[model samples]
Target chain A: MDRGTRITFLAMVALLVAAPYVLYPVFLMKVLCFALFACAFNLLVGYVGLLSFGHAAFFGSAGYVTAYTVKMWGLPPELGILLGAVTGAALGLVIGWLAIRRQGIYFAMITLALSQIVFFYAVQAPWTGGEDGIQSVPRGHLFGVVDLQRPLGMYYTVLALFLAGFLLVYRIIHSPFGQVLKAIRENEPRTVSLGYETDRYKLLAFVLSAMLAGVAGGTKSLVFQLASLTDVQWQMSGEVVLMTLVGGLGTIFGPVVGAAVIVTMQNYLAEFGSWVTIIQGFIFVVCVLTFRRGIVGEIMGRFGPKGAAPTGGGH
Target chain B: MFELLGIPPQALFGQLLIGLINGAFYAMLSLGLAVIFGLLNIINFTHGAQYMMGAFVAYLSLTHLGLAYWWALLLAPIAVGLFGILLERTMLHRLYKLDHLYGLLLTFGLALIVEGFFRNQYGSSGLPYSIPAELRGGYNLGFMFLPTYRAWVVVASVIVCFGTWFVIERTKLGAYLRAATENPTLVQAFGVNVPRMVTLTYGFGVALAAFAGVMAAPIYQVSPLMGANLIIVVFAVVVIGGMGSILGAIVTGFGLGVIEGLTKVFYPEASNTVIFVIMAIVLTIKPAGLFGRAT
Candidate 1:
């Protein structure tokens, strides 16, 4: 990462830290969680070159687990989030194993189908509380020290998690394994011929992505103090896709920008009701047709690939 | 008068009839998807929207033009097919050289637009489209009353599916189409206008969806949201059936529909998701789908 990128990221983080004092902390928290969700989804599609249409399985499942643990079993907030992450990892392993068998469109279809099953399970399973979901989840204490009932305190906690997750993703992307993933993305057969077990790497990446997505979902449920049916819907899956696509798939920090824009848009557009879906659809069409590189990608392209290690992959 | 496994035979056969009716729609729709995928190498995500359009068009024809069910059935596909043809000729034709996923994404966007627009105009609630007077009644088949319209839908879809199979598997035109799919450049050298053929193929495939929509209008409410969810299920069906063979799509569509219907009778809660459950199991055992060859 360059000085400019680093400085910009820090500024963004600072803004997020101060936002709760100025703006609504709960709303900001929602955006942060969604941004993290979008970022994790971006890791798979943008970096690993796998487009999964069923990420809600992880996101929603984690939310349910977090809610259940906190509300029913009386787990602390941090542990509830951890439980959610584990749920995501477990699902990712099974789904990744099955999905990696197919390539391209078929892989997408498999993920979608698997997630649909998860959706159905959530609907019927009594633990999910059916349509009612787990409501009024206690935020509890973080690390048994920081009181999370205060909006500002909760906001900082989420911001800390976001920053940690974001930094870890950045480190992963710059690491050696990340390079291999890029290779696999650019050309899988050639990578396989080069003696790398591409599927294993892909599966691992899938699991990590799922776990992070789960963290986001889990965090969001805590912030709202509820885990509901909306999280697992196919529409939620589509929303993540739209965010990543609009922000520029594969670009670092793009999902954050994309998620922020979308969340804000949805927040303001909520009053318009179904028109929100209509407008989002319009954005998808426009982005696919004219701006496939996305907002960050387009700007990054204008500056050239400067101050970065070359891995031979271009947008 | 008879009972099987303590369940009345009439209820059992009635469900079977409903299963067949559903299977007919599935067969027609999946056949369309398979045909489009074969030629264009693109999943037509807008297919469901076009199916919805077909129903809406038929409804419009009946309400506005005072057209009968038979005439609406004949006209709706043509109208929707022409719309699809225009779409292919314009936007979709440009993405032929790029990645196939772009086609899927573009069509998905188009689906959103179509479905959204309909929702805006017509609202989410379905409009009732009654069965034609000619086919309004039922047949007493000893065990159950099978609606004539339902039976007609099944027979018509069977004929359409099989006729498409025959034309594609055993005809001169089909040979050209297949050859083009294999190698468009080589087929072009043989004096075939491959691009035009692709456009027509897309139109034909979309028309098949519209045809199914017309058949479905009376059975289900003619609503804009009707096709949106069904298309995803059909995608699962296509994956499971392996889009590799026309016959595979037909058989799988019908089979899964019957399985779903049976699940509804035995375990009502699972009926909504049994097809997806079956898809997951299929993926675990046969990654390329039941009939799909490894790409």
Candidate 2:
């Protein structure tokens, strides 16, 4: 990573480490899980120019699988989360294969449709326990070493998971493969002319993104000891999109900040009930209409390394 | 009792009729969406919310103004259409030069605002819109019983769909519309009011959805949450139809509605998801859509 990026990231990490001491650790844990979720989403929209509207499928399903395994199969927490990540990868493989056939707006619609199919399955498939969901999921001991029953143990574990996912996304975005993905995003026809299999790159990026989303989802359920329809709902998918947009679509750490802002809003706005939807919708309109660069993206433009693109993929 | 394919004919035909009535709404809404997308190049993500508004207007007019159902049918579309025009002029028109996705995002937010506010006011529970006295009864054709209102819905929707098709495909005004959609600058040079047409096209498209909502008020509860639930399915119908052709949108919307109804008859659990399954298959085979002209 560049000096600018590294410094900013370490500073953010320090803030997160110190955050729980002052704020409720549970709420902070929720923010960290969603930050990881949005970062994975940014990996696709920011770099690859592919918008997958059904990401909640990966995030929610991984949560479900992890919750089911730990609570029902009696597996260790780490293994359950690993299995959740695998499920997300498998779902990505199938969804990406179909969704990549279309591009732009149609691509968004296809992902949304496929995710609805997943939502219906979650609603009907009895193993999910229907509307009640797999509740009271035991966080169990982390890797059979640290007892996660303590809020601090759970909080640090979530922070570690978020950092791992964030760093992995950073690594991928700077890799040669990420370069090819960006090339395709800028000019697909030229990328093809360069003899690159653009579709393969897209599919691989989609899989990686989905796996990370799954990791976040699985860890989230463990944190709350519950997995419900709320996670898999289309609104959750939209929430991720909003988080990504508010943070800055293409910049590193933009989605993390966006997720933090949104999660905190939900916590504060809980008493307003459905007013939250209106407020969120208002944010969507304002952001799309004017502030598409988002908070983090703007910060990067003014202070970070020069030559950063003014707007990231699919403004 | 006579059976068709081991299921009772009465149940099968009843479901099919329900499917056909649903198909009518799908046809009308998708047709409007097709028209808007063809000209504006942006999906009207708020189509559902506007539809719910149509129903809400009907209910509100009834409760507050003591306007009868017939009066609501006449007035709701105009009210909703005017609101749509206001939105088009102020907001949607701004995004014409940006990425089409921005338009989608903006409309989606507007929809959430509309639906959420209505839900807050009405508490998500449906308020009833009674069938007009003239259309309150049913007709039995020996094989199955049909509600008079439902039969009228099919007939009225068919008339509306055909009327719109004739106007767009055959009329002088439609000629101008077609030309404007193809080349607005040239149409403007020829002294045609292209911008007005664009705004009207958006309003008209939204009006079509509202009209369907008016028609649906009697059969379905006028609920805040109804449109959001229904519009996603309409989106699936639009995908299967493709945005390239007007007729394709009409035919596919009705076709899928019937197919969904049939799924209800055969595999009850899959009814909700059957259209989406078909959409996936169509995407794999013909990503542009079954009827849409390829770019």
Candidate 3:
């Protein structure tokens, strides 16, 4: 790794390691889960240039799956989280298969419509418990060893999962497949002429992104011990988009930063209720109009190499 | 008293009428979306919020100013259309050169702002919007009783939809719009004010949504969330019909509404999701949509 990236990584790890002692573990865990979710969302939107607006389907459904398995089927937390990730991948496969048929705005809309189907199912399905959701879910023991019920144990477990997901995303972005995805994003018609199946690349990126988002959602349910309609709502989908957009679309560290800022804001402004929506919308407007590079992107542009900063992947 | 497929005609026709009424709203909204998308090249994500605003405007006018339904029908669209024009001039016009996705994001943000403000002020519950005296009550058609307001909504929307189609397909002004959609630079080269046209088209499209909202005020609860829910369904309609042809939007909107209504009769549980299911099926078979040419 470059000296700058190495230093940033070390600093981030250090901060995270020390965070639980300084701040509330539960809140920190929430930020980490969302950070991972944003990173996963960034994988497709930033690298592949495909914005799947229905990502909440993967994230929320995974939460439901993990909650149900751990609570109802008496599975371990690790196994529950794995089931959640698998559910996300399966959903991603079905949704991605349909969404990849179109590009750009249509892709966003299709994913959104399909996700709404998932939302309705969650609302009506017997297992989901409808409006109340799967509440008071037991976090259960981690691999029959670690006591996840302990605050520190749970925090460390969540931290480990976040770091693993973050590294996985970093690896994907640097891989040969990631390069081809970027090539497709930069010029799909050219990529097609070069004989690469652009659709396949897009779909694969989508599934990976969804799987990771599921991981985040699953981890989040364990942290809170609840899987509610809020996670699956269209608003949650919009929240992740806001987080990714605010952090920086293409940069690896951007979504992490974005997620922290947004989750923190939500924590502080929890009592303001609907004003949060307005403020978030205001941020969205400002970001699209003036701050499209996002917080991390702007910082990187000032300090990092020229032309290294990722564009918004415009078509 | 006759039954079709073991169901009474009244039940089937009742659902069908409800579907047709819903189809009217869909046709109007999707038509607006198609028009704006054709010219502006951005999905107006705030279209739903604007529809909600239309309902609110009508409701507020009646409650505060003592104005009636007819006045709201006349004033709501104009007010909402002017707001839309202002939005286009100040904010939306800036994103024309960037990716279309930015436009969607901006509008989505705007939608949140608008919906949030209204929700903060009025809360999420339904606000009453009584039908006009002229349009109250129902017609006994032997088979099923049709509320006069409901029948009027369908007729009014049909007239407006056809009128928009006529203008776009047959008129001189529409020729310029069609030309602009094809090549804005060429249209500008021909000395037509394409930017003004773009702004006005957005306003007009938003106005169409408002018009639907005003028509919808009495039949449905004039609630802040009404548009938020309907817009997704309309998006699916846009996907199934493809935004290539104006008529396709109208046809698909009404057709899907009818189909959804039929689902309610045969299988009530699927009524909410049947449109999305159709969208999935359509994508698998014809990715470009029913009327859209593959781009």
Point to the candidate with the largest DockQ.
3
Ordered by lDDT, highest first, the candidates read 3, 2, 1
Docking class of 3: high
Instruction: Find the candidate with the highest lDDT and give its number.
Output: 3
Q: Chain A of candidate 3: what's the TM-score?
A: 0.99
Residue B148 alpha-carbon offset, candidate 3, angstroms: 0.9
Point out the higher-scoring one by TM-score: 1 or 2.
Answer: 2
Per-chain TM-score of candidate 1, chain B = 0.98
Candidate 1 CA-lDDT value: 0.88
**Chain A TM-score (model 1):** 0.96
**B210 Cα displacement, candidate 3 (Å):** 0.5
lDDT digits (tens) for residues A81-130 of candidate 2: 99999989999999999889887777777788888888999999998989
Candidate 3 deviant stretches above 4 angstroms: A313-315
lDDT string for model 1 (B116-179, tens) is 8899889999999999999988888766788889889989999999999999999999999889
* Local accuracy of candidate 2 as per-residue lDDT tens digits, B156-229: 99899989989999999999988888888899999988888999999999989899999989889999888886
Give the C-alpha interface root-mean-square deviation per candidate. Answer: 2.6, 1.8, 1.0
Candidate with more favorable, higher DockQ: 2 or 3: 3
**Ten-residue region with minimum lDDT total, candidate 3 chain A:** A306-315
lDDT for each residue of candidate 1 in A1-315, tens digit (9 for 90 to 100): 778779879899888877877888888898899999999998898888888889999999999999899989999999999999999999999989989998877777778878888898999998998889989999999989889998878989999999988988888888999999989988999999999999999999999999999999999999999998899987788899899888888888789999999999999999987788788888987887778788888777777465332221232
Q: Rate the local accuracy (lDDT) of all candidates.
A: 0.88, 0.90, 0.94
Global fold similarity of model 3 (TM-score): 0.99
